[model samples]
Target: MDLQAVVDSLPRYGEPLLTTIVVTVASAAFALVVAFALGLMTSSKHLAIRTPARAFVEFIRGSSAVVQLFWFAFAMPVLLGIQFDYLIAAGIIALGLNYGAYSSEVVRGAIAAVPKGQLEAATALNLTPLQKMRLVVLPQAWPEMIPSLCAFAIMLLKASALVSIIGVMDITALAGLIGSQAGQDRLVHYSVVLVMYFILAWLIWTGMRALERKAKRGLGVDVKPVKGRLAPEVAAGGVR
Candidate 1:
């Protein structure tokens, strides 16, 4: 293995790595918002509200993500006559819309998992529909949603590699470029790239695990304490 080639390429990855991280984070944020909006709409009792949201979720989820990215990058400019000056923005939207559809199912299922008794109690207490959802249903549902959302978010981070096709200059794009130039050292270069992606995915998983623990704790569920991290209970009480 030509270790020097990998070493020399490391510095070159800085900008491309940043691009990948930015796209993943922006796409995940957008997907989270869309997931909640569509999930809540689909969970509604009114057919009028639920139908369109369901259709949208199915359509986006059914279609190929690459096709969706291409449409946003190429077709959208011509059809909508609104060209995105930053191609990265278009890539982010496509990833968001695609994964948002998948993640919405997580939200819908979690909301449905809330016990019927909770709804009954809310109604008996004369809580408005909105109040019942806000105070009773969602708190219970949110903890369930986090694990699936984390999975989908990690999937989105991996899928962000597709944006390289649209010239966003992400990690995969640079890795491919470097590999082609390395000839005999191609294996070493690609192996390093694989490790880079794994590290990124692991970071996302760790962060999401922390969030999952926090969400479960809100419901008074016993969560194994995180090592080397101060608990909220301890933090609030301050030092003895």
Candidate 2:
């Protein structure tokens, strides 16, 4: 492995790295919103609301994510008679739709796992449905949802590489370009790319861990920093 090739490729990665970061951030934000909306709809008392949300979740989850990207980038333009200038928006939509479907289940399960007694108490207090969710349910459920949502966010970051196929020049695409030209140093180039992805995922995980701790603290739960990490079972919501 020629370390020199890896060093040479690093400088050219700056622009592509920015593109990757933008796509990941935008897609994750979109996915989070979509996840919460669909998750909440799935729990609605109205069969009319729950049925379509559940169906969309299952449909997106069952299909291939790469195929979805292709549909947005290629098929949609042909069908709609519109062409995207950069293809960034289409990639973000594809990633958001794919991961959001999966993350919605995490949200649904977390919301459902909240103590039934709390729901009854909220009802007895004569709280409106929106108030019940905002003041009672979401505050409890959001913390429980964090870990799974973190996992999905990291998956979305790695999956952002899929956009390279549609010609968006993200880090992975640039790394592939470097590898092809580096002859015997292909291994070195790709090894660097692998490490770059790991670092990005690690950063996202660390951020989410902090968020979990903050959410627990908001509920007055004991949140001791255990060796630079949150203590296990902090989700149990043990009071200080």
TM-score of each: 0.90, 0.90
Please write out the lDDT profile of model 1 over residues 1-240, one tens digit for every residue. 567767877898899889989999999999999999999999999999999999999999889999999999999999999799999999999999998889989999999999999899999999999999899988999989888888898888889899999888988888778877843366666677788889998999899889888888899986795689888878789766
Q: Distance (Å) between predicted and true CA of 19, model 2?
A: 1.2
Candidate 2 lDDT trough over 10 residues, lowest sum:
230-239
Displacement of residue 137 (Cα, Å) in model 1 is: 1.3
Tell me the alpha-carbon RMSD of every candidate. 6.2, 4.5
- lDDT tens digits by residue: candidate 2, 19-121: 9999999999999999999999998889999999999999999999989999999998999986777799999999999899899999999999999999999
Q: List the residue pairs that clash in candidate 1.
A: none
Residue 170, candidate 1: Cα error in Å is 0.7
Please give the range of 10 consecutive residues that has the lowest summed lDDT in model 1.
182-191
